[model samples]
Target: MDSELAAASQWATESNAAVFIRLKTESGVVQAMDSEEGDEEENEEGEGADVIEFHPEFTYPIYGEHERIFGYKGLSINLNYAAGSLATYFNIKYTKRIEQMESTSTVALKADDIDTPMRQILADSVCATQSEFAQQVVHDTRVFRPSGRKVHEYAGRSSQTEQLRYEIYSSSFNDTESAKYHERMQAFVLFFIEGAQFIDTSDERWHVYTVFERLDMNGQTSYSLVGFSTVYNFYCWPDRKRARISQFLVLPPFQGQGHGSALYSYIHAMVLGNSDYADLSVEDPSEAFDDMRDRNDMRYLLKHNAFAHIKGARVEQSAISELQHTHKLSRRQMTRCIEMALLKMIKSVKSQEFGEFRLFVKRRIYAQNMDLLQALDPDERKHKVAESFASVVDGYRRVLSLL
Candidate 1:
């Protein structure tokens, strides 16, 4: 009896492993549609179409912490989307399903119903049938324009050293037409971003910034969705607004090609250019985003005449306040950028200038954690502060190297 139970338990499959996600262009959908009436079953990448495949980074939100589906052998879930408009088709395949009523002189073993959770996750935006999905993909891709007015355009670096044109568009959530399409694309946030939730589109203050690749092929032009950022406008005390970036994501296929930097730069410029916004902030940034933000902010500050002599100077409150007013940055971020600038000025870590810079950073770290340090003895507190200062310096070095 124990041996039989052990054998049945071996059939559990990891949910992340069993799931496959693909982004297909209109040409790929046309190829699939032309083959047969219901030809979306196969999971192969068809020729002459740009089909990108990637897996979910985290599935604990959809599945349990174990992220395992039991009582199934060779379970596969396929999620296909139209790369432009993000129309979705979901399907599941399994080689063998365990019998729920097996008589092993014990309770019956049951298999997890994978479709129920997925249906809820996809929401009403997913098509009910594969044929319906095909028709929707064709129609949506043909008419799909990014949900906003084009605000900026720049060039991207591809692996082949080709300079590709990219455009950034801005839209508000109050636009009903764009909000409907944003609903279809929202599922990607759950798949790619950890601890991310769907936004409430009813609020008129929400805005979306999207990045798309401008593809011109055979005398026809099309735009493919690359990544996007969501920002919310918060009311300031004195008839002003504060902009906070809630979520930002760049698809895995186009991640390392400098697209994200371009998108962030555009948003940063837009926020600063608008006189109505008092400042700009981020809701909850991941470590990767923090590093990217640091590099970009430092780069921008370096271009200003006021920031030219900021290196190795005391990070005074007046200086911070003045820069914050002009740049619309939070005090904490402004302080960190100043530290980065100071570090960049030091010619060598072994020099006297590096010691002054290290002490400057230590002062800020100690002040930030003063409450906690008050409880510890003097030597222990000093040691802890030193550790924190070293970590901050290391982080600064990493960001500066990237710049």
Candidate 2:
């Protein structure tokens, strides 16, 4: 019995490794291959001709905290999508599944069944079988104009002669047409964003923004879903409101090409243009998103005349107030932007300006963590503040380089 129990252990596989996700396009322009070894691969023929294979960063949301799938050997779960419309195709396969029960003359042992847990997690309308998914009918994205008011359009970052065009559309959850698309698109937040949950769509305060790539090929035009963002409007007072960005994601294959920056800039512009939005905020932004936000925010400040002359280590209260009221920037965000602007002006570390900047950062750090720092000895508090200042400087330098 001991030997038999030990043998069962080998059947368990890491859920992250066993799962394979892919995007298949009708033009055959994008393809992601699955492998038992789980190595990353990208097949690029030219611009937008590659599909990068990836695994889930966190599967705890699907398979519990340990993220382990038991009772199976050689398991492969594929979650495929049609590129443009994002129609889903889900398929699961396994070489050997442990029998659910072991019976004897007088004793019986039962093991847990697989597939039941996953079926409940995935979307109900996904393709049921591999064969059905293989015959997927691509939606007519050419005529599929996004349902909402067309807001902003721009050229791709690397475009010069052949400008790659992209458009952004905004809609509210109240729109029935847009809500249907949101239901199909929300699954991406689960797969990509950490600690993300589906929002309550019944609420009228929820809004969505979608990005699509406009492809004009051989006298035909089509739009491909590149990424999207969700925002919730909270009433602040009698008339004011706060717009908080809840979820932001750029598809894996379409990432690192300035789509995230474009999406964020469009959302930021909407907030700045609208008088109803008192301020803009984000809900639990990840590190990568934070870095992007920092870069974008600083760039905006630098372009404006108010922040162009900011050079001192000391953060000015008047300037902070101006940013808060005029640009809808929060106090914390304005302070960070001021620090980054000061860092950009520094010529050398040995200069008096650099020394003042370090001191300024240390004071801010100490004030923020005063309650925790007061618990420690005076000498230790100073040491902790210095460590935090060093970390902040390192991060600022990294974000500045991206600009």
Candidate 3:
């Protein structure tokens, strides 16, 4: 077992490989040939012991790359454990051919063409699920003011009603020099909006697309359409499952209003109504169905009820290590790690009060939670931080939900 593992590790190091196991038995002639080697040579005074001739019965190869990689080693040990006399020898072969294929077949995400209206619609549709206001805007097309007047109108307004007319296109970011930049801007945006992450980004299991909204205001203008992505997980029982979402953003100025809701409505309609994308069915009925049904009812009410119900809750507790890791905090230790780091940086310049430092950390954490800056002392910085945080957190939250 140790020798086989060493060989596999060595092979993997040389070729970037994965391993599996295989089992086989020797043939009759081969077994006889092997047994003949064990016979004692003929002695001067005595005839050689009766020449024992035995051979293996049969042999078969296991299918699949996994078998070839790991099964070979497992078979070696299994054969060795077959007590009594030597039964069979499991052959292990190291192949560079398989490794090359694996390296070449890695799946990658590329930017979609953002030049068409349909693409924009798809992106926006995906994004809508993330932001309630964006959802509403996509659905209604007409944005309503606080007074219930159609004050802000999107493109494709015919007379008074807003029409949904968008297209999708394909683009590539491979030309981008920095892989991280392309991933952060393009791939991460999709994953973040979809509320998921890729354990292996090279795997071809993820599909990403972007939509660009077309505005025909005298001339023409295009806004970044919401991006959408889906992951194919075959491990789930029975059917292959995929989770998808629409528009994931509300432009800074266009936010606060009910555009997000409209976008979400459009996404719900798309997901539930369309067959080409994803299939939404309740799973684990006793657990998820009740809550899902309630949420669905609430959605219906929000659309119909004049007096809508809105609840706001704030939770403050010690951050767990997993939570910190998920949030991308540097320190593994939770208590005072972030706060202490901030204090050290502040004190490096001058003596800062503990209260002021605490406020700064609280604001930073709060901004992360709310997806917006709530600081008033530095209005410009506060606004910038808030907007940036909101944009990122919205995308993050959307993708997280999908996962």
TM-score of each: 0.91, 0.85, 0.24
The lowest-lDDT stretch of 10 consecutive residues in candidate 3 is 77-86
What's the candidate order when arranged by decreasing TM-score? 1, 2, 3
- On TM-score, the leading prediction is 1
lDDT per residue as tens, model 2, 101-202: 342333343333446666665656677644344345234434556677889988754333333578898998878778877877887787789899889999
Q: Candidate 1 — which residues are off by over 4 angstroms?
A: 1-5, 33-40, 44-49, 101-107, 156-164
Estimate, for each residue in 1-403, the C-alpha lDDT of model 1 and write its tens digit: 7876777777788998888888877777667667665554654445444677788886777877788888788788888887877788898888898886454657667888888887777757787666777677677656677877899998754444234579998888777767877887777788788889989998899999989887665554566789998999999988999999999999888898888889888888998999999888988899899998898888888777547646555667788899988988877888898888888788998988888888888888989999999899999999999999889989999999987
Residue 5 error, candidate 2, Å: 5.8
Q: Which structure is stronger by lDDT: 1 or 3?
A: 1
Candidate 2: regions farther than 4 A off: 1-6, 29-53, 100-114, 130-136, 141-143, 156-164, 309-311
Q: What is the lDDT of residue 127 in candidate 3?
A: 22
lDDT of each: 0.81, 0.75, 0.30
Question: What lDDT tens digits, residue by residue, belong to model 3 across residues 1-403?
Answer: 4554444443322111221111111122223334456442211111122112111111111122222222121121111100111112222232222222223234331212112322221212222211232233233222211111111223433433233333332222332322222243332232123232223445444333333343333342223232222323232244434333322443222334434444443444444443343333222222222223333323443344311221111113433344333322223122233333333334333344544554554565555545334344467665665575455334333433432
What is candidate 2's TM-score against the reference?
Answer: 0.85
